[model samples]
Target: MEITFYQEVDSTNSEAKRLVDGGKAPGFAVVAKRQTAGRGRFDRVWQTPTGNLALTFAIPAPPSRPDLPTLALMTGLALHNVLQPLLGDRAQVKIKWPNDMLVNGHKVSGTLIERVGKVLYIGVGVNLVSRPENVPYETFSLAEVVNITVEELAEAVTAHWSATLAQWLETGFAPLCDDYNAHLYGRGESLRISLDRERAEWAEGTCTGVTPEGHICLADSEGHVTRYNAGDIDIIRTLQSV
Candidate 1:
């Protein structure tokens, strides 16, 4: 495992890609204190403060990316494992499907996974000391929720991720699905999901659990169960929002 730090960069994910092109092997972690052009899925800009947390690590590609859902879920579980302790036993530190990490409905962290050649790059950004303004949804900072420093939180997340990665590699998602579902945000709530694009259309359903393969299980009002792919989902809090 190799770690590199940059005071500032255009984006940690981009930096990781560049390093990979420069012959950096898998398991190389690239972290930056600030990003001039941070981004997330759907080409949205990520508003993370300097000195907060922008971590991107590379892993060798699996036989297939079919397990990406499990990969993302495990990453969220890793963050939850490190954060739930700080939030106490009763707090709702949960993962919003596909990307967002929510603590009591407020997003504190998020992850992005991309495949480049034979390696997969996992990019994560956590709000430590600052939060963005005018976001589509609510956001939170670790400083507001807990008193820990970004460095401490980063170390904890990394350790948890390492352990979770091993567990996933050994047992796959079957053993982790229950654990992932337990911390899933809006698990049993009525949600309006737009598949493919955020601005695409809306479909309302009751949130069901996840599949062993990582697709979200949703039960429609007609009592039919449907499983959707892990990524390319836009969740609306209320049906009226659709």
Candidate 2:
């Protein structure tokens, strides 16, 4: 668990990938104090203020070629565990499906996982001190509720990520489904899912717990449960005709 710190970088994930490309072994991390071009899932810009956390861990790809979605949820759960204690009754921390950490219904952190050859790059961005403003969705930062430095948060994240990865490798995601679902955001609530990136097609259902394979389950009015492998999910705050 060697962690290389950077004062500034284009992106920690990019730096981690570069290190692996240069023959660096797995089980190491790249953390940056600032990222000029940080990105979230689907290439969305992730604003990283100087005091926030931008980290990426390089790990060996699993031999069985595990499902990427399952791995992503696992990463989110790792982050959730780390933050839950720090937040400890301060506010509610829940994991939005796939990999987004929400606090009090606002996004606080997010995870991005990418595979490079035989290595996997798990990138995490947390709004430790300051969060981006004027974003499409609501956002929050740990600084608002707790006082913690970026270094401390980075250390905690890497440690938990390593432990969670080990458990996933030893057993599988099946055993952890309940744990993940327990902190799931919008559980048992109506959620709107956009089936395509274009947002032209949509599905609405009551949120059921995730399956062992890591797909989000949604139950329709007729009691039919459909598992979605990919989609953008959002909690429906107000009732509307769909």
**How high is each candidate's TM-score?**
0.91, 0.96
Instruction: Name the top TM-score candidate.
Output: 2
Runs of candidate 1 with Cα error greater than 4 angstroms are: 89-91, 230-242
**Native-referenced Cα lDDT, model 2:** 0.87
Tens-digit lDDT track of model 1 for 1-242: 56787888998899999988888778878888788898887788987678678989888887765676678878877888888897785456887885568876778887888888788899999888788878867778777657876566767777778888988988898898888888887678776666556556656678887888888878887889888774433355543320
RMSD of 1: 2.3
Show how many residue pairs clash in every candidate, following the order shown: 0, 0
C-alpha local distance difference test of each model: 0.78, 0.87
Q: Give candidate 2's TM-score.
A: 0.96
lDDT of 2 at 166: 89
